[model samples]
Target: MKYPLLLRFLQYIATLASGVGKRKKLFILIYHRVLDAPDYMRPQEVDIESFDWQMALLSKYFNVLTLEDGLQRLQNDSLPARAVCITFDDGYADNFTNALPILQRYKLNATFFIASGFLDGGRMWNDTIIEAVRNMQDSILDLSELGLGKFDVSDKSSKNQSVREVIQKIKHLPFDQRKNYVEYIASVSQNLPEDLMMTSEQVKKLDQSGMTIGGHTVNHPILSSIDLNMAESEVLENKKHLEQLINKNVKFFAYPNGKPEIDYRENHAQIVKQNGYLGAVSTQWGVASKVSDPWQLPRFIPWDKVPHKFMLRMCRLYCA
Candidate 1:
């Protein structure tokens, strides 16, 4: 049936019946900034209320575990039914101000991967592009010289679309060139807003909140596009920076723009391991199995509105 309720009901029944004695899979859910209000330029980020609801559902239906615990379970082939781990990438300030309280309320442990270059009032290249596009004076943006076609930013919908398009284009560029383009645009786009990344103190507070702090590569580069030496430095330096800030051993890493083969490569994973990380996560959509690669553990962003469907997706992942 096409009805969400019916699909969810069927999924629940199938999960209970089929997954009764099966080896359960690990589902790692990933999120970015959790905001009080949606930033028009970055609508992909979940709001505080939505995140709260998702976390509530996660804690209820899933055996929510720490990243370390989850990995160990995977190694031992002893994951619980509906085993799930919560993670966030790109250390945004709202993650501390908004998401941390909800996680505390639920008594759930999460892993937050910080892009160290963006800490202490540094902005990500993507955010710079977003702000530049949002604050541009012209009704239509013409970047023909840069090979990007003109975009209409006169209305809200058009503006958001333009922001997304520009981000998509820049995401594929080499890290340094992407930075150069974003900076060039920001200089021309008038006064850009203040950086939205978490400060060093805020990041330390996140670690203090009983959450695991992980490295997310300095400047959040697409690892595959950059040279191996620079990629290795990004991963290693990010871990060291977080450890210095938190005064503890940071064990996990998350690849920036983390797709399996596109944003990162096998060599990048080796670099993460050589730098002394237990594991790393990628933005791949699937549940982790006993045989899954620790360095490229898959994670997905759940955007469904219905709690039942959300729970159903986790159930299906276990079944899968």
Candidate 2:
């Protein structure tokens, strides 16, 4: 869905009305890749050139702040107008080798959300499946042996999009079952890409370079798919891993998949706080406030195809 131009104008007007004359803050942009996306299941993981251009545009107007600073200023009401914060989810290796230098060159800082498990040969199952399908040539991939229904990977021109249909079939399973299905595909497939996910060393490099590390659950599981103990364990294990890696207080979180169905909820927030995290972030889009629950803040995912749409959204907030 498109953000109406008139609606944007109204947001600007509201900012003016709430605190006339000062710049107003607008967004928290969530990204996951800086190099090529293994597959484009979602558009946020655009290539480096597109990311460079997005940064160039954002650097022009906004005072991009680290996630903590943004929240603190948001509480103090000290943010400039057109303010926004940038975040990288899943802690892709490229965020260090590719995206970080860009932010550093622009002298910008952002929160780097790390899925504790994916570091050091831990590939997200979703990413593995996307790559696996992209490499496969056959129209149909049958994995009923692994207990999943058949996957038709061919073109969907005369009918629905083949990839979408395949993805729908994949998504139809229970979360745990679907991950196992991806694992089955990856184990059987060849021509796999580099473990595109980050390593502990890379995360340390970012932390030492002055970036903030946030907890994403270990194994990247859907919290709701499991019982309360398992969900708490997911949160605890992630925080423990990052703290051990960075040796600093890790206080933030990004919900895996960021959907209500994916295990992010009030219970998740309680786990975060009880584990001593200061705040948490969600994949849902919008601006946040001091009054906003830090454990349930909203985030805007930057789309790969449309930089102008990004520009308009950030004009109403901030970006890095």
Candidate 3:
């Protein structure tokens, strides 16, 4: 079926299934980077063409709102059918260079959650792993010295796998330990990209362009892997830096590696709230409604490439 027909059919199905007085559902779409072209090491990220079409579909079929507006209406029960809020996590420069123009073309708004520590030439640890593996001259990356296992980077496929394995191995480690591993990988790799993240000026430009900016911690640490006090500092400090940079109150938060209970806990949510954020989002896969906690709002991304299936999947999430 064509996209328009499928969307209409799905809308009718949703209306009939939801019946009367069903609480409004808010679908928060999460993104990391909108790449200029496909990167084998980060295949899941949407490229320029893919992101263009996705935003086109969103503008056409859904009532796309800013995060602040969406949550406020979700509370007041005033949301239109098929309401959604687009959000991007981490402060990638492509978000400004690649994602912003598409968003503007569609006249849509999105929230960007930034890891403040990575702004202005600082790369995230995972990106360190990805870039290191991507540019490695050796066919094999033997990390047995670091006890993270050896891997074959003989080709694109192996390099991709090695990147994933190495990141997973160190992702949840203590912050200092993870830093050491990432540094070791960086030292061994050649020609790593230094300009992966947005500069502070680009962040302010995003705000000037009328997009919302939210906090994603200072260092993008896994909150569960760090002490509570450190976690609190991460949350608060990020908000502080962003507000200072943008000259606007950063009203929302997205947990770094935003998994409930594992990456973050209830106390982390409390910290976000107490720090004066209006709300926060998690990496949970579902739709949010009135009964959902504002501090732990759920987020999802539909990975379907086909238009109809993608819209269908979105409808299913609403009814789920």
Sorted by TM-score (best first), the order is 3, 1, 2
Question: Tens digit of lDDT per residue, candidate 3, span 153-207?
Answer: 9999999988988888899999999999889999988887879999999999999
Best candidate (score: TM-score): 3
Q: Can you write out model 2's per-residue Cα lDDT over 1-320, one digit (the tens) per residue?
A: 13587446544543543453253454688888887543345443677777777787567545678888888887788876666789988888889988988888777888998888778877777677766776676777777786555766775331134445555566645667887777777775687876688888999999999888999888777666667798888889888889999998898888877865454667877877888987888876677765677788888777746655665555445322
Task: Give me the candidate number with maximum lDDT.
Answer: 3
The collision pairs in model 2 are 23-81, 24-81, 26-317, 83-318, 84-318, 224-263
- Evaluate all candidate structures by whole-model CA lDDT and list the values in order: 0.84, 0.73, 0.89
Worst 10-residue lDDT window for candidate 1 reads 13-22
**Which of the two, 1 or 2, has more TM-score?**
1
At residue 45, what lDDT does model 3 achieve? 89
**TM of each candidate vs. truth:** 0.93, 0.83, 0.94
Question: What is the alpha-carbon lDDT of model 1 when measured against the actual structure?
Answer: 0.84
